[model samples]
Each structure stands twice: as C-alpha cells, then as structure tokens.
Target: MYLLTLSESKPPNIVFIVADDLGWNDVGYHNPEIKTPNIDKLAREGVILNQSYVQPLCSPSRSSFMSGYYPFRTGLQHLVIISFQPVCLPLNISTLPQELKKLGYATHMIGKWHLGFCKWECTPTYRGFDSFFGYYNADEDYYNHSLSRVPFKGYFLDYRDDRQPVRDQDGVYSTHAFTKRAESVISQHDTSKPLFLYLPYQAVHEPIEVPKQYENMYPNIQSEGRRKFSGMVSALDEGIGNVTAALKQKGIYDDTIILFTADNGGWVSYYGNNYPLRGGKFTIYEGGTRGAAFIRGTGITGNRTYDELIHAVDWLPTLVSAAGGSVTGRDGQDLWKSISTGSGENRTEFIYNIDDDFPPVEGHAGIRYYFFIFFIIPMLPVLMGDYKLIEGYPGLFPDWYKPDTEMSSLDDPVEEFMAREGYKADNGYQLFNIKEDPTEHNDLSTKNPEIVAKLKARLEYYRKTFYVKPNFPILPDFAADPTKFNNTWSPGWC
Candidate 1:
C-alpha cells in the first residue's frame, strides 16, 4: 500500500550537515566559550535532542547514518585504513539518499567522505548519491586541498555528476568550499524537484586550520592549538550560516528539513571536549558517542527539546517517515513521532561497540607530537549505558590521557579480558545507571546486582546477534584489485 497522498503537495527538501570530531559542548548551545552564532541559531529555532548518539568513530558512524544499519552489520566494525585493505559496504543494502532518490530527490555530498578510501563499492555515487564533490581520504590538508597523489595533489576536489567525473577547481579550503558547493547545489535546484543536500564538513577535524578572520576571534584562548581549533570551529559555524542563508534565499526554508549533528564526539584531548560526559571519540563512553544534534523543518515546530535516546541509525527511517515514505527493514525506528508524543513503544536502549580489527594488527610509530601521533591507536570498545564492560586491554595505557607517550600497545589484547570470535572478552563488567549518572562516574556493578545481571545478559545476546561479521568491499567503479589501477589516482582521491 504505497501512498502517494502528498502528490498534491510539494515534497520537502532535506539538508543534513554533519561535522566531524565536533564535541557535544563545542557548539554555542552547549559550550559557552565557543562563538557559533549560526549553528546556535539552528538550535534555537529547531528542536535539540539532548540525547542523540552515533558510533564513536568516523567510518562506522558514517556507515550507520547513510545505510540505516548498525556499523557491525555492515562489516564496517573497524576503521578503513587497515593494511591497505578495502572494506566495502554491502551493495545490496539501500542507502537513505538512494531511497530518497527513488522518491525524486536530487542528492549531493560535499566535503569529507571517510566511508571508504579508494574502494569502488563504497563510493558515494555507487551508494546512491546523485552527485559528490569532496575528498576521498579520511583527512586531507585543509589548506593545500590536494590529495596525496600527484595527479590529485593536496587539492583534490572530486566533482561527480551521477558518477561521471566533472571538474572542480583547485585550491579551496574544505570548510568554506563545502558551504559554497552546498549553496550552489541548493540554488540550482528546480523548484519542482525536491533536493537532498548531504554536507559532511571536514572542519573541526584534524590538521586544524582556520581562516585568519575567525582565528582572530578566539584570541583569548591561551593554548595555540586550542585557539586554532576554536577558529576552525568558528569558520565551520560561519559556513553553516552561509548554507542556511542560501536555503532561505531560495525560498525553500519552510519546506525543507535540516539536520545538524556530529559524526562522533570531539577529540577532547585535542582541544575538543564533551565535558560533564566521560570518554571521547574512540571510546564508547557518553562523551565519545553523545553529541549535539537537532532537526528542524517541514513538520517540526520551534524550540522543542527531545530528551529521548536516538542514534544516527535512526535518522534514515525517521526522516523517511517524515517525508511520507515507507520505513523499511532497519534496526532504527522513526523517532520523530515518538519524541513528539512520548508514548511510542520503541526500544529504549542500544549498544555501542567498536570491535578489534579482526586479526589484531599493530599500528605505525609516527614521530608527530602527542596531538597528532597518539590518535592512530585503536581503543577498546566501551559499551555506553550498558554493563560497562572492558573488552580488550583493560588499563593497558593508564597514562593514555597524556599526549607524549612512546610508540606502544593499541595492539596487544589485555591478557585478563576474554577473546573469542562472537563472545565478550572474559573480563568482568562495570555497570552504570546512565539515567542517573551520564558520566559513568560511579560503577554500579557491585551495588545493583540485579541490573548488572540484566544488562550482561542483554550484552551477550547483542554480541551473538549483531557483531557476527563486518561488511567490507571496494566500490563498484574501482578495479577488481584497487592497487592494480595506476590510474586509481586518475579519479577522486587516489
């Protein structure tokens, strides 16, 4: 029973802006220090879901967002750059934008595409976006704009029209360029056709650099790195303002649904913080998974705050439902209605786990300072709000909080923990009643025996059911074996 009831009405446009490595408290709404008036306006005018989440890392969170599936189910459990291995997302699964494209929406992705590197199968165009203009690597020099390859150089801006390569000018800062592209896409959209703009900004991520204008705005911040990072965030905020203004100028403001959130929590140690919340980016702690988020447009009213539990995986189904499309097979539920009435009978809590790269491999020993060097290390999975279990090495690097430790163990499995394919490590668990303590400050495993028993049983079931095998494959356009194509550098970022 496919309903076309909205044929008489115009379909709403959608613009989803996701920031990378942005902290929960980084936005003006949360962080008092940062001056992000533009993003803050979005929060003020829209509903801010105080309890929204995503996977702790970039690729996994991105996979969950685009495909409406848990990262593990997509075989994207580990980060992509492992042993030059290409981990492809299963092609059969339909992505959110792909589904919307079927419903007559023009899709465009600007800026960071960390989902897959050179793998063909996972390219945004192959995954259902109508157009893509961005970098392929996880992180690129914000200023140089070149990709690593000579042909691509530091300034590789891939502009694709339905998968066919188009020309993108060289030498544009990633943050401003993404906004400019987004504005161009929005302005060019035919009023008759609905548009879906997917802008994932690389701003606020690493190699932090900001235009001097915004850099000078945060002169008060003492640390040089933190000040520069703040400037980058300000620039990103300004970019958001530009996109918002463009949407308004096109007269599509009321009929469009706009979403703003992060790919993961801020890299707290690197001048990012999700303060009052523990853990960050790589870990499954609240600070890692929890982030600032909001949705405004079409059916949403102003200034409402939804405090229910929602994950990145839920956005697809929820947005689909809002767009008058049918919600299909997925682990997510349409949260809009639930948040509206607060009476929907949906699953309450979910799990967040970052699995060890199948065969535990070692990482590089780079000479960069604590800020850039230490990030290469993979962290153990900390199941947020669940039976606070320590999977791999427990307290292996007690001094991990510090920046300048030697090249060390992100590889060795903590001997005490369990190590089985589909089961949890043999380590004991630490439970927390997250509703009472969002920080996981107090361990409740010993005090609340019954709750501990309940969550542990739940964890066992989840590990068996979802964490079976991860999805990994190259995009369809790339050669069968990526390395063989000397011209892999010919397209996108090689």
Candidate 2:
C-alpha cells in the first residue's frame, strides 16, 4: 500500500502565482507586450502548457486549484465568496494543501481568499492551508481600501495571519502589501519542511488604481483604463521577478516547481485582449474560459509548448502526483508523468459551464450549486482528438441582466428553465474541431450532426447527473434536506 516509501527523493517545493483576471495574451511569452523578463525567463527555462485553463472568475478557480475538485464540487461555482456569505468548503473533500501537509509540507496562502467569507468551514485554515492573509471579498480598492462595487457601504482594510484579523494599515496598497507578506512568510517559514505557497492576487481586477511609481510605466498606452491595467500588470511582473529572485537567493529555485496562471480569460471590455478567441468573462466561449498556465523548476524544463486542453481541476491530481502522494481518489490524473515521461499526449475536449447558481441537491443550496453539478461535477478524461460537444444553448447569454443576478434569461422567458431539453439551434447544437478552430470562429453544427449527437449525449449525462434539481423559492435549508428541491419546481438557468 505504500506506493511511495518516503524515499530521499526531494519533493519539489511549490510556489503557485495566480494573477487576478489576467488576459490570455497578457504575458510576453504568449505575445510580447509590456516586457515580463522574469516570467519570460520562466518560459525560456520551463514548459508552457499552451492549453491550460481555469475558471472564468477568480474565486471558483482558486477553489478548484486548492481543492483539486471542480469548483462546483467544492460549491464555489460562479459566485465569489463574500464576507457575509459562508466561508465554507465541503468537508468531505480533501484539499491540495491538506495532501501536501500529510507529506510534511507547510502550506500557506497569501493574497486573495475570496472562496469563503464568514463560513466556519470555508476558512483557509480549515481547508488545509496552515496560514492565511488578505481579503475575503472578490475585489478591493488598491489605495483607498474602498469596496469595488458600491451599495455595500463603509469598507475598511483587514489583514490576517491565520483566520484571525490584524489591524489594518493606512496607505497600504493590497498588492504590494500581500507580496511583502508572502516574501516574509517564505523567508521565515521552517526551511526543513517542503512548502506550498498559494499566492492569488487582486491586481488588475477593477477600480483601476496603480501605485504612483507603477502608474507612470504605461504612458504610451492609449486608453486610461488600459494604461492603468498595464501598470498593474507591470507591477505584478516585478513582483514575480522579486519572488523568483528570493527563491534563487534561498537556494531552492531548482528544487521548487513554480506554476503561474490566470484564474480566467481577460475582460475584453477592460481593453484586455483574449486574441483569436470569441467572447469574454461569464460566457462559455473559449476566450472567457481558456487561460494561461505554465510550469517551471525541478523535473520540468525546456520551454516546450504543449497544445493539450487542460482545466483548473487538473491541478490537484497533478500536484499530488508530482509530490509522490496518493491521487487515486482524485478526479484528475497525475499530468506530471504524462508531460515529463512523454507517456501521455496533450489533452483534447473540454466543457465550459457558466450557469449562475448551484443546483439544489438534497435540498441544500451553496452559492455555486448550479455550477458544481453542471461543469465541475462531471468526469474529465482527455480525448484522442479535438472534437468537443457543448450542450445548453450555444452562443452568448446576453449580458442583459445585471451582474448580481444568479441566472441568465433564455429569450426573455417569463419563467426560468434550468434544463434546455429538446432545444435545437437553427444551426443545431454547435460543434467545433478545436484543433482547427481554437477560437471557435466557425460553427460546425450544421455540417457535423454526428459530432453533435456524441457531444449532446455527453452533455445530457452531465445535466441528468448534476442539474436535475433547481434553486429554492426561499433560501432553502442547504444543510437539512438538499434534495427536496428539484428543477421541475422552478429551475432557473439563464
């Protein structure tokens, strides 16, 4: 049963850097812009996962990354955990940090903790992270500490070492401060044990504000918001450079596996470019869901580019495998061996689930219940080819509703319907050979009915398994009887 004998094999230390709302083409390695020499160096010396992916938003992606389960499984879904909402993750699941802890690695998270707000179960400490700091809300003002979206009055600052809050400092920008805390944690942690650092930032998300020094770096950028974004990205790049240098200085650069990626596709409206792809955040389109993922250090090298289609859910199994831990129960396979040993090829086929709410299961409601059952709850096996079928209504779910609405409307229907059964597009269910069209420019639904049938079956299974239930008329009891609510009553997925 002891698959790994605790051999003297040095388990690689992990430093995961996740940028907030970064675009697919934001990094120089993807397409040169704004000079990221440090990140570029990582690509030059490491491997670029050309098709790595994450959730379309920040919190769920983070949840998926940490828990090694789809965000829906973790109950994060499309919703960002607000402080007032429950800060809980499902207790039955095992988290990546928890797995690493069993291997004697110290796990720490510095920066955004939007996965949970006040829920007792959702705290990072409870989820296997040994230490935590930063905001529980999705976005915060950079300099003034103001809440990004108004209506919620009076926002102050909070800093935490574990789950406990510390006095907020005046004049401190969240990004710079979080980075400094991370640097301090890295420098001061027990060096004898392996370390897992999950650093998710709040930079470039919203309320465009850059440190005065970084602000001047983008005078050449035309638009005001874009210039601010560029400045923020530059600062993040500098932070990476500093962090990597710190690793080198500590003599652990080669012993660590540093993974850098974005939580989702860019906000094109923010002047962010997800070039060659259609749509942006909140859509199931490639641009909104596809992301940047790369790995450097230890057994990974050569700056090789992989065209595999990977999702955020794979991180858990991949890291667990790389760390020589048990991943048999995990949803994802150990991608490390495949990528490193050349035994496996790039992944093909993927699903993008963007429903707003979580499906009612056992009469319970988590904010992300709909997302959990639909996208995150499904089995993800790599395909031999690039053919994928997307169920649910194809095309954009018009942003006609406010961002706060949990579900989208179908054709301005008087009532909401979670299940889009027997629904046929004029073009039929859209199909795409992603190998030929990663951008999804051409809809092959009309041309390929066979592919549609295959994908539709898969999609139907996905629906039957997860979204058979619906949201509650009232905020139903999530803990008592989650299955009492069903889609037949009032299923709403717009």
Candidate 3:
C-alpha cells in the first residue's frame, strides 16, 4: 500500500456521515425505487464499496468504527447499550475524534451518540468531540425528542446541546434539525483549523415518522410501513444534500473528505430491505453484516467501485492516516491507498463476530481469513474461497415476514412462510460456491468432504485461540428502570 504524502498545505477537512439502519438497496444507486439523488451523486463522484461489512448491530459497529478495534477487543461485542447502562467505552482507549483533535482539528458531532451516556464522562463531548448536539440513546421519538423504551416512564427528553437538554427541540423532525445543526456548525467553523464533523443521522430506523410532504412523496408504495420508511430515507437524503451544499458554499467542499456509510444492515421488521441477501438484522448473514458504503472527496479517485473487503474497524485508522496522523496497535489497516487508488486488497483477515457464549448460536458469530470464512455458530458455514459449508440452518433462520403479506405483525413470519413454501434444510452439512451463487441456492458439501474437513479444523483452531470471554459484565435489565439506577456514575471495565 502506498503512503499518503501529507500535503504541505493545510490538512483536508473530514466529514463522516453515518446513516442508521440503511438497507443495501436503500439508495437510488442500488435500487431505482429509492430516490436518493444526493447519495447517488456521491456514487457518481466517488468510489462505492461493494463488500463493506459492519457489526450485525449499531452500537457494536459504532464502537468498532471509533476504536479501530474489534468489538470483542473493546468489550462491546454483544447487544446495544440500553439507556442508563453503566457500561461504556473504556476511558483509557483513544478514539478517532481524539486523534483528529490532536492534529489541531475542530471535532464536532451532530446527531446520534448511542455508544454510551450512563455518565457525563461517557458522552460525546467528553470522548473527543468539542461539541455534541443530539440524543444519547439507541433511539428516540423523531419529532417529540423522547425515548420509547417500555420500562422508562414519562417523556425522557433525549435531545441535548453539548451536555444540556434542549427541551424546546420537541416537535422538530430530528433529521431536519440535525441537518440544520450541521449547517450551523459548518458556517461557524474556524477555517484556520481543519474540521472533523461526524453526522450520524437517525433515519429509516424504527418508529418511522416523516414530514407530511415526505410521507406523500411515495404514493405507489402499498405498505404504509415501507412508505414511511422511504420517506425517512428521502428526508435523510435531502439533509445530506443540504450539508454538501453548505460545504460547497463555504468553499471547502473540494478540500473536504466525505465518507458515508450505514451503521449496519437494515432491520427488516422496520421496513428496511436487504434484498437478494438471506437474513436481516440480528443474524450473521450478509444482510446483517454487509452495508452500503462510499467515500468521496478531494483526494479520492472518482466514479469507481472498490470490491476489496473492508470492515467498520478500518475507518478509524484509514481516516487518521489520511489526516497525517499515526494509528498504532489497532486492528484496522490504513486502507487509504486501497480505497483511493484501487490498489490491491489491504485487509485479508476479518473476525466479524466473537460472542461471549461458547458454541455461539441463536446469537451468531464468525471470522474470515482472506476468502475463507468460518461461521462457528448455529450454522457452521465455512467459506473457503468460493465454496461455503453449512452444517445446519442458522438457529434464528427464515424470519420470512413479507411486506406484501404480514406487514402489520412486524414479527417473524419465516416459519409460516417456509412451511407454506415447502422449504426444508439440507439433512447434513451443506456447501455452495457463493461466487457463482450469491443467493446461496446450491449446496455441494457432500461432494466436497475434504474441503469441509479442512475448514472445520480451521474453525476449531480459531475457537480455541482467537475467541475469548467477553470482558465487560453484561448490564442487567434493571438498568433500564430509572428508579433502580438513576445516579450518573462511571462503572469499572474488566
């Protein structure tokens, strides 16, 4: 990989935009049904990553992106941190914003900050961002600015400005408000110092609410849920357009590095669609791990597709390297050359998931080395090059709730649909050449016992050596009850 020569001139401004629960086909570039002109423009002017992977869920993905390390290494491998959870990103560990802050950059974060907020020290402002304007929970009401967790009583206003709650923000559409905040930040930025703006928009997620204008934009969408979901995405797209326009108006668009990606795959129950890929959110399938990603900016080569494998953890080191900063002892690789120049693959190994439970199942986990993948959970799908082995069905398989039929339930209809379709799992270990069948419709395991044996052995080795018990104590469900744990105090990490 070629080292990026730091320009004698000022360092380029970095604008990192992350979308919440955006499906693979959610963008106009991937599906004509979705009207995402702003994101489409990025695809036209930058490189689209076809094989970008992230954690199966949001908090884990965000942690990996911020830390340049696997979730397992950071003690954030499991589920999302609930509101008031004592657990948080360890204070000793450095973050992307911290690195940028060290390089004389003005770091600002607008929108979601779901990593942790149990203590004031765990919030964005304390973790490297100079200013933070957004909510601190996994999700909040788009318009009311209130969290929706069942046990949390009353309207817990989640909107905040730097650390203080902004009670007046109620009734403001979060997507629009966040965009306006970003524009304000850009307009007020000190040009003498480069800017590191992180905009993680809460769009197309649950409680899909949109402005009336946006809601009426898609009259043809039969499913009301899907229609609302589309509206949320369109709103986000418009917000992106506004942000980019602000950058251009400031004469900094050409000098800014813009990286856009979804936090993870779509949550199908919420009308998010990851078509042509089996499984959705909360599974180890491609639908849960793979996401839509692109990078466009001054120094990047435009109008290209980079099929090289990349993980969420790679962004911290990659962006830090591009900013002329050093990132040592991180799992991420400086993929600046691979991403910008179409250079050969920069990452050959990826351990996507390592759960705390032994013989991980229902909760899926796995690892990939080059073209080989060893899925250690329910379905032991070991993929070596093009061929993949599946010992059984993923424990949590076929939640086949279709938008056309069971949209109202918002629950798994996979079993009913499977029985109706007369679908059956292969009796023994199954294999397929994914290169030829991206949909994984064919099985060739019985014919290739030797390959299966070799991969199984490798899987065993990984389980014994690479896997470790989760470091942090799992937060108890009582943590969600404000009365039981109302105090703001930092909890010790393992």
Judged by TM-score, which candidate is best?
Answer: 3
lDDT of 1 by residue, 225-288 (tens): 6778788889999999999899999998878878998988776545666777775666566777
Span of 10 residues, lowest total lDDT, candidate 3:
485-494
TM-score of 2: 0.80
Q: What does candidate 1 score in Cα RMSD to the true structure?
A: 10.0
Clashes in each model (backbone N, CA, C under 3 Å)? 25, 20, 2
For model 3, residues 1-494, the per-residue Cα lDDT tens digits are 22233346888899999999898867889888888999999777888998888887888899988888887776677667766466677778889999999999999999888787766777898899999998887767899877645455655667788867687877899999999999999999999999999999988778789998887888999988888888889999999999999998998888898899998777776788777776566555667777899988867777888877789999998998778877988888889878988864567666657664432322344544445556667555444575445443332333433433233362334344344544233234555565576555565667778766765566556557655455444434454454442321122221
Instruction: Report the lDDT tens digits of candidate 2 across residue range 382-454.
Output: 3334664554443332122211223322432212322442222222345666667777777676787775666
Preferred candidate (lDDT higher): 1 or 2 = 1
Model 1 alpha-carbon drift over 4 Å, by segment: 1-8, 81-83, 117-119, 147-170, 340-346, 354-426, 470-494
TM-score of each: 0.80, 0.80, 0.86
Count backbone clashes in candidate 2.
20
Of 2 and 3, the candidate ranking higher by TM-score = 3
lDDT of each: 0.66, 0.62, 0.75
Candidates in order: C-alpha RMSD to true structure: 10.0, 9.9, 6.1
TM-score of 1: 0.80
